[model samples]
Target: MRLYSVIIPVYNRPDEVDELLESLTRQTYNHFEVLVVEDGSSKRCDGIVEKYTNKLRLTYFYKPNSGQGFSRNFGFEKAKGDFLVVFDSDCIIPDHYFETVEKYLDKHQLDAYGGPDRAHDSFTPTQKAISYSMTSVFTTGGIRGGKKRVGAFHPRSFNMGISKEVYQKTKGYKITRMGEDIEFSIRIIELGFKTGLIEDAYVYHKRRTSLSQFYKQLHFFGRARINISRFYPDEIKLVHMLPVVFTLGFFLMWVLPVVSPVLFFIAFTVFISFFGLIFFDAFAKEKSLQVAALSVGAAFTQLFAYGVGFLTEGWRKLVKG
Candidate 1:
């Protein structure tokens, strides 16, 4: 049995860490060690980690505030496993997660892998709606963990794992934040490391609790996409630009009325039809009217916020250039 070191970087989120730790205790496979790295958080999880001392092979480390990427690197430095796995603090590991990964690895020869995220049954309706928009084909084309990706599947850090050799060669993340995962994944591929998606090894990712928080998170994600493009200019694809087009078209809809009512009517119709599609798709997947309704708002918030962030950061990049 290959040992897996699970590294979780936490900030001021003790409650979330507690929940995540509790979930890890139920994993069916027992060949994993958990490392909780505290990144200069005031509300520490030391007390919470104490609770799991007997339940899991767990270690807690406190370090000065470096962003999540570097905090993960700190964990990577101390990992004593054949493979190092990274998970966000705001995630719940399913009981069968490791068993599925071990089974898959026995057949495939991937040096690194990433898995999709789903909203847990216990998540709030808003959280589920946000998850739908994030993973929906109508929005992100299900690329985050979906089978239909734009290009090569770049394993994200949230549910990513790599062999100890990969870390020894690449030395983990380069930048501390702003799309660090994307940058690291690109480097991993560039270094000729094999990467793939482990579809069955998904995690229950409880993203932001509220729509406003979700918007902020997506907005930062949009900026991060542009940030990744800085490291790998060729990575910018049509799929990434779709949000910008949506945002620009949204503003054009209102401005078009001043120029020509026909143009505005056309844009308005297209926007409404697109959002209607999102609503129906969400309904089909969730089977809840309330969730479907909230999904529309979530989708809009996602696209608009991401678009604005993309444009905002792109302009800054251009100015600096």
Candidate 2:
């Protein structure tokens, strides 16, 4: 049996980590070992591991608070499986997730694979809305093409797997604040390896249920983009660039409204159009009023928060430069 090493980098949230372990315990596939690398956190999580210490294959490592990129790299170095799978601490996988991934990999002879991330069904309407907003074309920066074998310009490391040779050849993760996954995937594509999305390999992610948590997440992403720009110059493309542009456009148009009503109209039109698309796409899935409200609020919140974060980071980068 080809062994798969599932490497998860966890920090601070012991409760979610417990849920992750519980999900793993129920997985149908047994040819896997889990390695949980604890990035530096103030809370002690040794007891969490103790619950599953009976598994001889389970290993835990503690390192000073490094970013997720470094924690994942540390896990990759210690992984002994033929394939390395990485998941965020909050992800809850289906029972057949691994079996489906293995089947898809062998069936297509692909180098890497990922799938759709579904928001937890049990989430509140606001949480579901935020989750949908993140997945929406507006907030996700627009991922085109419906083909299962679609390659993202910037794919996430959250639900990704790679061969041992791929890491050995390219070296491991970069110590970036964010977008390390994109950099890593770009390298894989450059190596001429195929990446696929198994539509059936589904996962449920816990969306941030509160505004405070949501802002913190966006803040990290904002800081991450700043650091990644140092390496991948084109990291800020149309999908990501539009929101910032619109934000600035809104501000500029506000000052010049008396000069050109057309410019002011255009700015508001774009803003409405952007949110319209998000709401339309979300409602198409489920025509519930709650979902609609959540979707709209989430989209607005993300755009506003992300725009502020981006400009803040941009200013800091410019000052440093």
lDDT of 1 by residue, 1-321 (tens): 999999999999999999999999999998999999999999999999999999999999999998999999999999999999999999999999999999999999999999999989999899999989988888896678898887778998889999999999999999999999999999999999999999999999988888999889989989998898888899888888899999999987888988999988888999999989989989999999999999999999999999999999999999997
Deviation in angstroms for 317 in model 1?
A: 0.9
lDDT for model 1, on a 0 to 1 scale?
Answer: 0.93
Candidate 2 lDDT at 58 equals 82
Clashes of 1: 0
Per-residue CA lDDT of model 2 for 56-161, tens digit only, reads: 3688888998888888888989999998888888888788988888777767876766666777777778778877877766676545212322235334666778
lDDT of each: 0.93, 0.75
Off by over 4 Å in 1: none
Tell me how far the alpha carbon of residue 5 in candidate 2 is from the true structure, in angstroms, after superposition: 0.6
TM-score (C-alpha, index-matched) for candidate 2:
0.88
Give the CA lDDT, 0 to 100, for residue 171 in model 2.
80
